[model samples]
Target: MITEFAPAKVNLSLRVGALGEDGYHPVDSIVVFADWGDALTVTPSDALSLEVSGPMSQAIPGGEDNLVLRAVRLLAQASGQDAKGNISLVKEIPAGAGLGGGSADAAAALRAFNRLWELDWPLDMLAGLGSQIGSDIAACVWSQPLRMTGRGERIRLIDDWPDFPALLVNPGVSVATGPVFAKFDEAPQTGAAFRPQGDLIGALQVATNDLTAPACAIAPVIDDVLAALAATKDPQLVRMSGSGATCFAIYPDEAARDAAAGAIRQVQPGWHVFPIVFRGVSAITPT
Candidate 1:
């Protein structure tokens, strides 16, 4: 059996631009993955199959539309090999919360199959296949701290990225990306023009998610989620990740992050609160 971890994706800094002629919004952001998320296992089988089971598994589809199947099928087509595996996915990330859960799962499948089939493909090739399926999957394929731009197709790995203690809270609500983007089209947030200051934390302080306001408009509860994070003690940075519903706060240390998580859980026991140290990876050239 082969096992893979699909970490939840987080956007530390997301800046979206006007909708382009291609009917896609241009985005510039720094993306990271948490230490916790879905877990997947694969075993060689006569035919390809999938089974999803987890706290949030009910929210995911188990049929052909599932990204895992789609990703693996694409890989097989590219490799001219049969896709044969009994795949199991234990989902932990909330669906439709803009955390790139589906994409992460698909990336996990690609990575797992790369080894399961002994393809020995490079990350770049896997990411190329991922990009054809989802905008976020390519970044998830890398699963490292990187700068993503051009509607999420372009990526440049950040070298010597620092792993920071952080808190992620979901208000037990799922906010779909379509509606959020629709609301954004109605009245887009003016993006702040800025550049990476070499100080990642500082760069993040100046950056913001353009989808925050629109997402708040779709789900008023999102405002509460952000407020809850802000009320925490000494959060160096507090903002929405991706579109909405899931917000995160960066703290100076793990101690601070854990305390904040405890306080939030005490107030809202129903909310999904996770304390994690965002993982970092060495730099690579832009792809």
Candidate 2:
């Protein structure tokens, strides 16, 4: 059996480029994995099957259409290997909270299958397969700080990014990415090009998630989360991650993040909130 960690992804900075003729919006974003996420285990089997369990497991689909199942099948087809396997997904990241939970799971499956089958495919090949599943999948497969563009498939490595402490809060609401993109009146046509300046943290401070406005339009509650995070006692930059629902506040240190998480948890007990460090990989242990 092979086990892999599917770490949640946070869009540190997402800039939407113009709507393309293909009806997909191009994007330029900096993505990072989170400490909180899902776990996937793969065991050889005569048939392909998936069982999802964990705190957020109930929210995921168990059918063959699930991204994890699809990902394995796609990889098998691409590599001409048997796709039969038993995949167990232990979910933690909230669904549709702009955390890229499903995409991460699919990427994890690709990585595990590559090793299990000895396909020895390069990471780019895995990323190409992942692109068929979801735009975010390729970025998740890389599982590092990257500049993503071209409908989230184009990836360029970024070096010298300093770890930033963050507090992520999800209102437990699913905001569909489609609707958020639809809400954009004037989207970019050309891809955004920019160089990282100063320290990684400093560059992020100047960057922005272009989708935040449209996402807020689709889900008003996202504004509340952002506002709350912005209102924390310590000075922090609050922005909506990904398409919607989950928002994160960047803090200077871990202590500040912990204090912010505690304060927010106390005030919003019903919300799914956690303090995490933003790095290339998640700090949370995979189930």
Candidate 3:
């Protein structure tokens, strides 16, 4: 059996450009991995099957439409390898909260199958396959902090990224990406463009997640999360990560993050809160 931990991703800096002709938004953002995530286990089998279980398992789809199953089918068809396997997903990240939990799970399956079948496919090829599953799936395949642009398929590796600690909070609410994107009056039309300034950490502080406004509109609780994070003193930046609902506040160190988490939890006991340190791209430590 092969096991892969699909770590949750946080968008340190997400800039959504105008909508594209394909009905997808062009994005320029910096993404980072967190210690919290889901788990995927693959075992040899004659037919493909999947079961999902975890704290957030009940929230995920369990049928053919599940992204994990779709990913496996896509990869097999692409390679023409008739591979089959049974996959078990232990989900912890909140679904539809903009944490990219589903996307990460699909990416993890691709990586596990690549190793299990000895396909030895290049990472680029795997990532391209992932894009079929979701925009964020390709980035999750790399599982590293990167400057992502052009509908999330374009990635640029980042070095010298500072180890910033953060507190992630979700209000146990789900927001749909489609409605959020639809709220935009005009699709952003910036071509693939990114200008990195200062160090990785500083560059992230300067950049912003443009999707926050629309997301917060759909789920006002997201605004509450941001307000709660901002209430804590010394938070480097308080903003929503992706399309909606889950927000994070960066701190200089773990101590500050821990303190912020504690304070937020005390006030919002129902919130899903986690204090995590940003793992650099090279640190592939599984969640």
Model 3, 111-205: lDDT tens digits are 88988888888777888999976999988988877878888998787766766788889999988888888875344434345577766556556
Per-residue C-alpha lDDT of model 1 across residues 168-272, encoded as one tens digit per residue: 999999898988898999976657644577778887788888899999988998899889999999899999999878999999999999999999999999999
* Tens-place lDDT digits, model 2, residues 176-199: 887887777455334355556777
Better of 1 and 3 by lDDT: 1
- Let me know the TM-score candidate 3 reaches against the reference structure: 0.94
Q: How close is every model to the real structure, measured as TM-score?
A: 0.96, 0.93, 0.94
**Model 2 accuracy (lDDT, Cα):** 0.83
TM-score, structure 2 vs. true: 0.93
**Which candidate leads the pack in lDDT?**
1
Instruction: Name model 3 segments beyond 4 Å from true.
Output: 186-194, 283-287
